[model samples]
Target: MKSWSVVTDHREWHQGDLALPSDPRAWYQLGAVGGWQVVVADTPRTVAHDIVTARTTGRAGQTAAWCSLPFAVPVLCTLATGTGVAALQTAVKAASAEGLPLHRAVVALTVIGEGRLPPLVRAAATMLQSQVSAVVTVPFDPHIRAHGLAQAERLGRRTAETGASLATAVLSAAHRAWGDPLPPASVPAAVSAPAHAVV
Candidate 1:
């Protein structure tokens, strides 16, 4: 129901050098300040998996068994363009058969040339809508030197009618999404600190 954004690199994702905000609190604060939910992570898949796993389990893990808990909000997974729609559909169908419970899907519009939101995006959104709670579009570019925000806004507006969340990726060194909003009872009393903790 709320608009959200996730900040990650548009180029290849490296596990150790993620350019994101520093902590979980910072991530929540950014969402609060921007009046939109924000998801920050070391990698896009990690973030997505965190959300999915958190929904299913109170904690995060690398295995499917870790995703046994039920998800509170809709869970979205990235389906970048050029990955072949048929492959995606097949994967989706297989996941469905296995009862993976993926709630939604996202596609990055930054891949399109000339900063244009093509019909393919809308069509994919439409198709995926029936299978998931919503289809979101993220305006991302590794090079956001000029017209980045403007392009994101334009794509967002174009897809507004589909009831999907519109978002853009930003690079921050001090804010990041940690497994907050965890079922209160599930949180441990002395959890380990984040990797980028301030000394």
Candidate 2:
């Protein structure tokens, strides 16, 4: 994501115009007021290992093949497939420790956890969730309570909002005894309690 300028309205979203790059890969760019990097791993062990190495080395972590793109002390965006929120929690701790101020650690736990969604919508779910989460949870640079809800209002297309399509992406385990590839779909509509539930 180049610079998440400020999502003015939903009209801009459907148009995929928000002062951001049109590159679809930009959709995978997730994080805070500044910028962030995606840390995708197949296992929690690997994820934890990578996080640790990054923390100790004071360098951003990347997959064996990926080149770490550190954008101004970027926050970490994690997507792991092996287990629970333990790894995510670790990220939160790391960010907090490093004074990220507004770091995020989200994941699609299990597909079964999120009822179900059609394939295409299911696929779009993660992208939307990441965008929404990062936008809503901004830097304490401003009063969090004051600016939080407004962020959602501006990006939610309804400035161009996609309802159920914006639900959490839950997954069980991809390469497990009882697993699939990733989560089903749907992001958390509300930061705390949602006004309407998504399936």
Candidate 3:
């Protein structure tokens, strides 16, 4: 069975298969009634102009367990947006019109870079990193094409190139932060499981 995410209006933040209370205007605060201390700000990539950061002190699922030289990754999750929700609702309506189940309707959009998936993904990462200082958003390049689907694809791809770009970026960030182990000359040569993509 597929897993569906539940978001409680402006009280919680959730993004998965099927969002509960599929109201397009349902905005979540990213941090909810949990042990997490969420503080929303601007994107992490723009610390030069403005600074938005979030951190987890454990007791929550938002901590980016740092790998030191492998990027200061916090517990990564997808972001949602008004546009993304509208697109999702459009898909849902189409599915409903076709007499398909909610999952069946939503599956078509889950494919990365297809239809509304990218916007939703981008929105999610932006919102997350904006809130938590430790989080980040990987803007995938056309050539690199980071992992957009399942962990199975990220791990089992023969080329092992799915999340290579993101991993490379993380490793580079790690190098910058620690300044050791020299840095990767190439992506394929450097990217590896467990060490590369933290997902």
Candidate 4:
């Protein structure tokens, strides 16, 4: 059996320099937030390296987390666009080489107006389905949060049977994939009531 760990790029708001989450739950929560890209890996070192590299390429103060699951379960690589398909494939290949299972591969699209899953996103999910245990879609549009949340909920329910899931503001796809327990009620809600209902 394999153990899990997490390395996060998030920092608390304070007067001093940045601070990382000392607890795995904190890392999980940060990754669960909307608009952030999440990638899970079988090996901690590789995932950490990838996340660090990815973050360095972007702007500063960009928060992220590298979580290790409780078991040597499947990896859930959550990407944002079509451009990330190649990276997903590479990560899958690497995990296979290391004999680590992949749970799900999710591609989050930040587009408005949704009916069925987009063809390109569908193609990517289909392509990775064989490599991973499942493939999921997260429809997200910051401008229209409610619609995206509704679409995500529908997709999550539709794909639940196949071991796939959706990403929402209240409940993220990463947390669902990781099987992380729900946060305490004392914790503040991430989204409004209408949006929360969708997840």
What CA RMSD would you report for each candidate? 10.9, 20.3, 19.7, 14.8
What TM-score would candidate 3 get against the native? 0.26
Q: Once all C-alphas are superposed, what RMSD does model 2 give against the true structure?
A: 20.3
lDDT of 2 by residue, 1-199 (tens): 3333543453522355345543222333433222332222222234446556877897765422122222121223333322323455554555445444222223332222223434543444344344323311111212223353345544433313222222221111111212344233222234576588778
Off by over 4 Å in 4: 1-18, 21-69, 72-75, 103-120, 143-164, 167-199
Maximum-TM-score candidate: 1
Write down the lDDT that model 3 would get.
0.31
* Per-candidate local distance difference test: 0.42, 0.34, 0.31, 0.44
Cα lDDT, model 1, residue 83: 46
Residue range 1-199, candidate 1, lDDT tens digits = 6545665455432335645543444544444465543343322334333445545676533323323322223233443454434445554565565465444333333343346555665566678667754455544444433444344555444344332433321111111222434322232235487799678
* Residue-by-residue lDDT tens digits, candidate 4, 78-110: 444555565666666655544443444333333
**TM-score against native, each model:** 0.40, 0.26, 0.26, 0.38
Which candidate tops lDDT? 4
Candidate 3: the clashing residue pairs are 53-132, 53-133, 54-132, 54-133, 63-75, 64-73, 64-74, 79-124
User: Would you list the clashing residue pairs of candidate 1?
Assistant: 21-174, 21-175, 22-174, 22-175, 55-70, 56-69
